[model samples]
Target: MLKKEQFLSYSAGAIVAGMYCGKLELNGDFFAGYEYGTGISPSLDPYFRSEMKRLEKEAEGDLKSYCSLARLMFYKGNKPKPLVAPLLIDKP
Candidate 1:
């Protein structure tokens, strides 16, 4: 059986997929105007930052490094725009 956090992670991924494909309504506490890639708060979670730091070190290749930088910008906000935006798809 999946652990609680693992289940939630899968469920959240499913929700994101559904929303992106226009199968789900974008109405929720989680959906708050980060759609058009704006309004992200700059408050970085300490634990998340630490985890990212570890992952960043493990990350290989320029693309991986770029993706890490994009994720960091996503959480902390207000950095220069990434060369390619993070893979989050918006509603059509």
Candidate 2:
């Protein structure tokens, strides 16, 4: 019986760890290129855009709604259907 805060912390930790490994995909190219002004390949733009649009619709374009949905997904033993994980490591 984990407390609410603890559960949130653990869920976040799991997401981080998953991102650290290769099991999960990185959140977005903007994050990947934070230090540099780069992004996903132009060829992949359409695919990424469509995926984001789908997620946006799911969240009703609201940040709070998106977060709540993401948390619920985590609680329900499912990863949020969005590229929400943050980059955990940088590769050379």
Candidate 3:
């Protein structure tokens, strides 16, 4: 069985990875442009916003699944493991 600390660490890492990936997918280009003072395209604003919302939802779902799996592992007495594998596995 994974130690408590190990499990917590795994969970934390998973959460951070999920959030970061989500952020990148959602606002990567916008943030890059904003940082470089590039003006936003008016025509693309709506599309960007819609895409961001979708990305955010996807990220949240990913995070929730990560947490849920972590909880299950903990309950099952499985050893604390890296977060990447679980996240990479497809879910139906």
Q: Which candidate is the best by TM-score?
A: 2
Model 2 lDDT per residue over 36-60, tens place: 3432242244544454445545445
For every candidate in turn, the CA RMSD to the true structure comes to 13.7, 14.4, 15.1
Which portions of model 1 show Cα errors greater than 4 Å?
Answer: 22-92
What is the clash count of model 1?
A: 0
What clash count goes with each model? 0, 0, 1
Residue 68, candidate 1: C-alpha displacement in angstroms = 20
In model 2, which regions exceed 4 Å deviation? 1-30, 33-39, 42-44, 61-65, 71-84, 87-92
lDDT of 1 at 5: 37
What tens-digit string does per-residue lDDT give for candidate 3 at 1-39?
333333334334433343443321122332334334644
Instruction: Please report, as a residue range, the 10-residue window in candidate 1 with the lowest summed lDDT.
Output: 82-91
RMSD (CA, Å), candidate 2 to true, equals 14.4
Candidate 3 lDDT score at position 55: 44
Of candidates 3 and 2, the better by TM-score: 2
C-alpha RMSD between model 3 and the true structure: 15.1
Write model 1 residue lDDT over 1-92, tens digit each, in one string.
33333333323433333333332222333334332244332223344344444444443335444444444332222346423222232334
Local distance difference test, each candidate: 0.35, 0.39, 0.39
